[model samples]
Target: MTRKTILSAVGLVIASFAVLTALNYATAKRLYHSLTLFNESVIVENFSNMSDIFETVEIEKTAPEHKFGQAYQPLPKTYLYKGEKRDTENFLEKTSTTALVVIRNNDIMFENYYRGTTESDRRISWSTAKSFLSAIFGVAVAEGHIASLQDPVTQYVPELKGSGYDGVSIKNVLQMSSGVRFDEDYGRFNSDINRFGRTMALGGSFDDFAASLEKEREQGEYLHYVSIDTHVLGMVLRNATGREIADYFNEKLWSQIGAEDSALYIVDSYNEPMVLGGLNLRTRDYARFGKLFLDNGQWNGKQIIPAKWVTESTTPDAPHLKPGKRDSSDINLGYGYQWWIPENADQEFMAIGIYDQYIYVNQKAGVVIVKNSANINFMDNGFESATETVEVFRSIVATL
Candidate 1:
């Protein structure tokens, strides 16, 4: 072929590929809830959409931000996931991982960034923010702002009156057992949770959406993962403490936890923080929170979280919330206040989010691993399930 003819052929191939990519995006976007940033073409178009979905509450760092000590340690040559040995690069690629930070002995042992992310990027926490809200509850309880766990949530947030949360206790909401019927299907366009996302995307009131949910079962009857339960917790905190969630978070947790940077929380039309999720922070700052939990809420000679609250929040004290008792098929796990417990755990728990975000805490091993990803198919394959992700963290901690 002549030079010009060959060049023309290559251009034609490129144009065809671009057309195919656009077609894929159009189809996937029709099922918009499932169209994630993991798709290369979609991500290129919609990656910035996260910040646009909601207004943000800035958690300012008070003077003297706690800095993490650098004592870098190399990762293990290989770690096992699903009975197969894998290297670090393979694991990151498979999970669509963005950042991984391992903290051992109060130091950064291993930290890696991927997909153009840096150490300073304030990656969205997704549902992992639930754990942060749970921690904030500890502070509220300690300060006497929240009188008791058994107190009815309606006592504080009377706005939930006549709704599913009418008679639910604060603890019920914390444990995801308020028994509200919410479809948390991430793949379904019409799921209730995705509808909430759509509402937030357009500056709708989260309080109104939460209060609109009808009751399905008796409160505290059985364990069900209704995320809006966490929003109720925020309402209780807001009423009981007479403060915004962002200010409380900064005063109670962020300022003293040795966080190197301020974090951001997505807000609603009423300026209510999205406590159910929508917390964004640096990976190292996330590890700081994990380390605080591992140390029983102590950081730098200060008890940031009450030690007793730490114990109660990490253990599945409620009968139905037991790891093995609640559900079988895939979620062979228990839940605490807002934390997830692995089966047969030894003082270990995790804060997980959809799309593969994690903060795995192993108290026995003195390890806290934080992972951030944009995984679109996290729920599809058995290997990519949350259970298998725990196995990966365990293997890494074991090698350390």
Candidate 2:
């Protein structure tokens, strides 16, 4: 070979190596960013800009957006907690709330943004996305896609056979009673939930991760808060409908809701929506969903979700699913097809997400409040923050 030709080949190889190195570095940086995403200094920004840190699928908003009537009222300045009148705005600040929107009777009573976020920012839904997934699942079932809630999930997602989800009924999974053994303590670095987070950061398949789990007990006996159960429901929805979740959800719910801006779902490596959580939307849009549920799945005089499904999914119909302290459940809150029923309920339910995200609906009071927070102290004192937040919501509704 000629000397000049050999040198040219060597230069080409060197250029390729440099390019690969740069790509590897970029990937590593992104992974690191995702790993430390919840750090106190950056969590607020991270929650609002998750699309930049992760792969996402857009749920497009249709034209003729549903606008809420505005009747701006100042939030109650004080809320009672444990017989003490605590400052309401101070509680919001201490909880690191990014946004709060209060809606009553299809009108926005109060709305505000904080922590360098705006009305346009799409805040991460976290586990509150489960309620959204549950809503669309009802649509699939109503359209004759899913035959029955009593059918075993394996009947739809055969891929889950032999996994923890095998022999688990659709109803049991919806109630988070799948008997799947999962450690959801997000504070622990080596916990299953945290490992799942890392899987997203490193571009791993959520399906594979789910299929790796083994059952801990029989299905439908106890109320365990297994987040993956909701993911399995997503798989079933996709398999039953034979359509991508985003497209189906947009057609069935998002498009019908009159959302002001396009929402997003943080996807896994294979572009699967993280139906367990990972929904992102503006706070107003979140309240719109809350309002939909408050109105028994009706929006703007049109029935979006079946009224029957709405009632069944939000009410704890079985003893095992009832709220309050119980040995059969890991949580004191009641379970209802991905919705939460708080103790001493007064026709109220909520969709709660980690780090203090909540869509609180009070049916009798005609209030729907959307609260988004980056509360680093969420796990402190065994989640007293959540209890306190719920009390705050109740107090606010009482004033209205």
Candidate 3:
């Protein structure tokens, strides 16, 4: 009687454990699916509408430039209502923004969220990730993993030999002048950039994806913006250090920069990071990165990146020519390494991303504006408005 009862009780315990496990699994799966649907339908869809609204507005005025750190001290609080309108409403009405951050003199001046974006949300950086990649390159160089910016990318990624990046120096790739015929038109579904995105999304190896491109012209002769250039940079960093880009970034920058929160790099199906545009982080953490650059790569009294490299990488000395030409009359906006230099009086530059992501750094005004958006269709329109908004913000800082 005792043996039979003991066996029966053991069987019942096992059965009960199995039932609990199955219930937990089902609950987790259901929650994940619901969150995914909300992200796509609510977050992404609302962002699309905001982008469309921004495209219709015409930015007619420019703001005056203020001296760096003069207007706000110890960071200005986020303006709840500039007038009768909420700040989020202004972005939805005037710009395609899911998140926006403004910092002056290493302090947060203004931070805002729109379309349900929040401080904890991790927004996509798009090509703004390129500038971040460039910073990693700087750290690699400083750490001696990469010999120099002048080193040819092929030296590390031998597979790129005879490809579009065959003779391209790391510096050329950083400047987006590798002379590869990469179509960056996001509106065209069949464009090369879109093809690359598809390849990334489909679990293709980034190295193989980049090697598939053919060289169209000599490196360093054109100012064409090629996203692959950054990929090549990532490849070089990987090969040179024999480490994953995410691991390298976490050790060399994120952890060292005292990032307030953990960030995730969106991974491909095979777990490879979409190094070109898949970085996601909090807005204030992004501000920390911008402030690192503003401080010449010094964080907590440590030289995180060589100050000289920061100076040269952002300085615009390279010859800017139209694509496929050695000479042109177009007054090209300045570009150095992966950073963009505005064409006006203020010496402000930015790390701009598709769909309105921006790391706008104004050295003269001591302001850094970091924004993230989902405007996959409106490129030129967004840029024009962002430029104007930056000028206006700079002007307001000056008045204060």
Candidate 4:
């Protein structure tokens, strides 16, 4: 063929291929956007009707038991929030939230949704899942799967022997006093915590991800809020029970808790459940957990978790209390066995997640509050402002 003819033919082929590729890309992008919008729309619909569902969930009786667990018998009377009332802010107006459920005396008193969140939306729990893991540990101990709280973590996961977690005790890990140096600053992309998150997101094994840490301090000397510490606990659970975390949770807690719907833990690419912070569930199901704790580990009269264990784990005791600090900024909020003790008179404690997820249970008032949010960048000023909203909800429960 002539040179000019050959060149023209080659250019036409290349142009045609580029056009097809661009069309494919555009089509895929449109589909993704559509799906996301649909999901968001569903969330909004669910949130809009959540108040009715909250009203319908019977608060007078206890939840029925299943294979995994049962719900606690709800108390009869609703408590009132006598504190100062605040504005009722919608979740979407403040931040990205899918659902919020509040229960008072076993009856769902306040339930709401925003940003297309629905009762079925399985939003990420972030660090809040740590407290749930701690609950599983309690069950493991009571069932004899784990011998004792005093047992060294290394006994369960031997690979940690030469690591920073070497000398850390189970109690210390539970209380987040592992003293291992970990940068929890989520704002800095280069921080250790962020690096770890990236590794997990890229499909690294939980064990291998943990083993890459360098020892920074002696175990149990200080309270260091590190997410990896919880993963170590997950390893301990897996080693002790010879099962995956998801299986253990399903068998020991989820099924028994009388969970209304099956809840799934967000798994890594390799199918390893993100034990540190990948839990997701319906808002009602999350409230069920809070109610379970408020009932002192009893579900329909069956002691799924030992009462003593729940009391001891949630109580602000050794390794958790900072003596002589009554709301002092210098004193870290009392932390216990993966639970957060608010600086309140009634010893109100909560399970808090990043970006505003919360499960606030007040045994004194027989109230439980569960909220989920996606507040853009972590540690935004909005997070601090959100606390006021939580307090407002707490007040509303006290009045119920």
Question: Candidate 1: where is the Cα deviation over 4 Å?
Answer: 1-49, 325-330, 382-384
lDDT of each: 0.81, 0.91, 0.67, 0.67
- The CA lDDT at 52 in model 1 is 43
Model 1 C-alpha lDDT per residue in residues 1-400, reported as the tens digit of each score = 9999999999999999999888656444533633344465554123224554346888877758666667786766677765787786676687788889988877787899988778878878888999999998889999999889999999999999999888888988998888788998877879998888877754469999999998888877678778899988999999999998888888888888767877888888788898988887888888988999999999878888999999899898867878874442235678899999988798799999888889999999899999988777788864246776787787778877
Clashing pairs in 1: 323-333, 323-334
Candidate 3 clashes between residue pairs 3 or more apart in a chain or in different chains: 68-365, 68-366
The CA-based lDDT of model 2 is what?
0.91
Write down the lDDT that model 1 would get.
0.81
Please provide, for model 3 over 1-400, each residue's C-alpha lDDT reduced to its tens digit, 9 standing for 90 to 100.
6999999999999999999888656545433432332243554553333222111111111222112232333322223333332343444445556776777785566667776667777566677778888888887887789887788989999999988888788888888778888888776668998777665533456678789888888887668788888888998998888997877877777767666556656555456566687676667767778877888888768998788878877886655732112362132456787887765537566777766677877767776778776653445652455555555455445633
Which candidate achieves the best lDDT against the true structure? 2
TM-score versus the correct structure, for each prediction: 0.87, 0.96, 0.75, 0.76
Work out candidate 4's RMSD over C-alphas.
Answer: 8.6
Q: Which stretches of candidate 2 lie over 4 Å from their true place?
A: 2-12
Better by TM-score, candidate 4 or 1: 1
Model 4 over residues 100-190: C-alpha lDDT tens digits?
A: 6667665665566766556666555678888888888888888899888788888888888777788678888887777677787766668
Listed per candidate, the RMSD to the true structure in angstroms reads: 10.4, 1.5, 10.1, 8.6
